[model samples]
Target: MRILGIDPGYAIVGFGALDYTRNTFTTLQYGAITTKAHTTFEDRLSEIYDDMTQLLAAVKPDAMAIETLFYTTNQKTVIAVAEARGVLLLCARQAGVPVFEYTPLQVKQSVSGYGKATKKQVQEMTRTLLKLPAVPKPDDTADALAMAICHAYSYRSKQYGVALTKRQQMGYF
Candidate 1:
């Protein structure tokens, strides 16, 4: 299975692509789609949509794993990120890629075996799991890879016909 993980943002959308097979993960690509700060908000969104459309076509992922929106102190930032996420979802739907949403806690637990793991812990664990020489740069990129790893693990559980508990089902939600 090919999975694309996304860390959505209006300024920079991070993405990582991975191929999972027989319980193994191989990194295919990882990067960010950045929009200039000087650009108009509408233009930034248009850039995101265009870049995401190209990414979806290039990666051709079977599934897209994205972090769900979480409460933040900055309402404007949150709203902007939400809009970016919406564009990502739209692109995935248009590309016929199944989308999976994971909370930050779920992603941490999946990647680091602990829901309360710190950001550095999760990044370190993600690096260890993927056998990367170093943690991916631009924190969002690392987060994106973690999201991909999370989905691979979650999907594997389902692939083997494992029964999910109520809480696990809620994780999918």
Candidate 2:
């Protein structure tokens, strides 16, 4: 299975693609779609949408795993990221890819086996899992890879007829 993971943001949308087979993960691509900070908000969003669409076309992932919005203090930031996430989801849906959302806690637990794992721990574990020479650059890009790893593990288990509970299926455990 090929999975695309997304870390959505108006200024920087990060993406990682990986192919999973028989519990092994092979990195295909990892990068960020960056928009100039000085650009108009509409222009930034448009840039993100276009870049994401192109990525979907190039990667042709069977599914997408995205981080769910989880901001409590910054309303503006939350709204902007949410809008970017909507565009990301639209790109996946248009490409006929199933989309799955995971929370920060879930991502950490899936990557590092601890929900309270630090960012560096998740990054290091993602590198180890994908057998990469080094952790992917740009924090967002690493995060995107972690999301992909999470989905790969989950999907692989499911392929063996392991029934995940609702909480686990939704990545809340």
Candidate 3:
């Protein structure tokens, strides 16, 4: 499966594409869609939508995993990020990609095997797991990749059941 992971923000929406098969991951692409601070807010949103549309076209992911928004002290920033996230979710929905939302703590746990892992620890584990020479830069990009890894692990949790045991006996999971 090809999965696109997103860390949404108006100023910089980070993205990563990875191919998962047989319990392994292959990083296809990772980058960010950035809007200029000087641009009007509406224009920034437009830019984000356009860039995200182009990214979906190029990546053609089977599914998308996104980090869910959490409350923050800065209401303005929260609102802006939420708007950007809406665009991200809409693009995925329109493209017929199944969406999965994970919290930051879940991502940390899946990527680092520790729910309380530090940001640096998560980044380092992501780098090591993907066998990258170094962690992806711009923080957000690394975060996006971590989201992808989280989904890969989530599939494991989803497949566990007594009913699935018969299916697995026939070769599944």
136, model 1: CA deviation in Å?
0.7
TM-score of 3: 0.92
Q: Of the pair 1 and 3, which is ahead by lDDT? A: 1
TM-score per model over all chains: 0.91, 0.90, 0.92
- Tens digits of per-residue lDDT, candidate 1, 4-55, equal 9999999989899999875578999998999999999889999999999999
Q: Which digits, one per residue and each the tens of the lDDT, describe model 2 over residues 19-113? A: 97755788999999999989999888888888888999999999999999998899999998998889888888888999988899989988899
Name the best candidate (by TM-score): 3
Rank all candidate structures by their lDDT, best first, as comma-separated numbers. Answer: 1, 3, 2
Q: Scored by Cα lDDT, where does model 1 land?
A: 0.91
| lDDT score at residue 145, model 3, on the 0-100 scale | 95
**lDDT, model 3, position 33:** 93
**C-alpha displacement of 82 in model 2, angstroms?**
0.5
Residue-wise C-alpha lDDT for candidate 3, range 1-173, written one tens digit per residue? 89999999999988999998766789999989999999999999999888988899999998899999999899999999999999899988888888999999999989999999999999999899888999998899999999999987785567565345554544455
Tell me the number of clashing residue pairs for each predicted model: 0, 0, 0
| Candidate-wise lDDT, in order | 0.91, 0.88, 0.89
